[model samples]
Target: MIGGCAPIDAGGSGGGGSDGGARGDGGGSTGVNPLDNPKGTERGLGVIKSAKDLAEAIKIIEKVPTKGRGPKTGYDRDEFGYAWADNAEEIPLAHNGCDTRNDILARDGEKLKYRSGSNCVLVSMTLDDPYTSKTIEWTKQDASEVQIDHVMPLSYDWQMGASRWSRSKRVQIANDPLNLMPVDGSANSSKGDSGPATWLPPAKGIRCSYVVRFAQVALKYDLPVTAPDKDAMLTQCR
Candidate 1:
């Protein structure tokens, strides 16, 4: 219903709910349709539909620039605060409260093995990681092994500019699909709270896309960035 979902195919053996597909268009790379997904992207939600949509989103975020003494200069603070609540709590199973971990489970998990429509019990679910570009062999395991990474770590946000966000804004950042990506557990752990300047994905080729999304989120949220982060993002954007 988020208009961004654009319902491609709800039928698939992978899960009972909607199955996300890739947006590909056989043309120039610039012509790449964010909605032209031929191979499913295991997206947290989906890509922004157009420059206009992206611009609109940016307008909203710019009004809420990051404030305060952000998270520890280097550590990726989970300091996102209230804006993170909606995705972390306000959605469907939100009554009990939503944590970053479970929120991603519901958003990224295929069947969403939940406790009978409640955010209570978390069970097994299939996750096709998009960052590592690998499908994790299906298995039932501990929660730590299966994790949800904040693409722009909350800690990073704290220093970069998230420290000043109102709870409402933080919740928005937490839930925004553009800011979230499902990746390998170990990779997520290793990359914990690091930014483009300090870290880059092991899959070098994906860096362009990765920065693109990061810029999309930062610009959308009006979050601040050091000169290096801005330069890196601009370079990637080009």
Candidate 2:
């Protein structure tokens, strides 16, 4: 469950049947491709079907160095910044008078409803959850059905190389749109700090795109994943 999921028309786009806008066909949606959405500000994870794109994806993954995971000696959620802060430096959508959570909700969701007189707090929406390839018709009362997931999870960041990063830099990565997605809460929960070696979208066709997105975040922060994770990430592009 997440914040602001409730069934209210409020002139918002209505959910499209049981499918909402999601295809729910087991493969990934025909949403934006990872190569086209390097900033991770795009809508959904589409299947990467082109050899050219896959080749580019490989190059991106290859740029990230591999290292053994370090001890999470002092990893705290707060270390990244208070959850969903809009004050993080050098990140998009920060200080926009709305929190990071709401900014993402607006970015990915369709058929959206906003709270009365509030442009930021979404009251309801239809989400094409890329992780599970499911169409989620969510209301404010049923918020947990969807969540904003960190592609390069904060905890994973700690174990990878972020334990040594400065506080402001840590905050930037935490709230960066390049590392975020809105997806099925259950799928997100399953990922819990694991990387490509152990976790990926349930939508098999999205794997290459997912791993590519993961690599984007890693390289952006100059962070390294475990060797196995890097190998797994490279494999997904094939």
Ten residues in sequence with the least summed lDDT for candidate 1: 25-34
Instruction: Note the residue pairs that clash in candidate 2.
Output: 1-143, 1-144, 2-143, 2-144, 5-139, 5-140, 5-141, 6-139, 6-140
Every candidate's lDDT: 0.49, 0.78
For candidate 1, the TM-score is 0.60
lDDT of 1: 0.49
Model 2 ranges with Cα > 4 A deviation = 1-30
Q: What is the per-residue lDDT of model 1 for residues 178-229, given as tens digits with 9 covering 90 to 100?
A: 5666567788888867766666656543454555556556666667666565
TM-score computed on alpha carbons, candidate 2: 0.88
Q: Listing every candidate in turn, what is its Cα RMSD in Å to the true structure after a full C-alpha superposition?
A: 7.9, 5.6
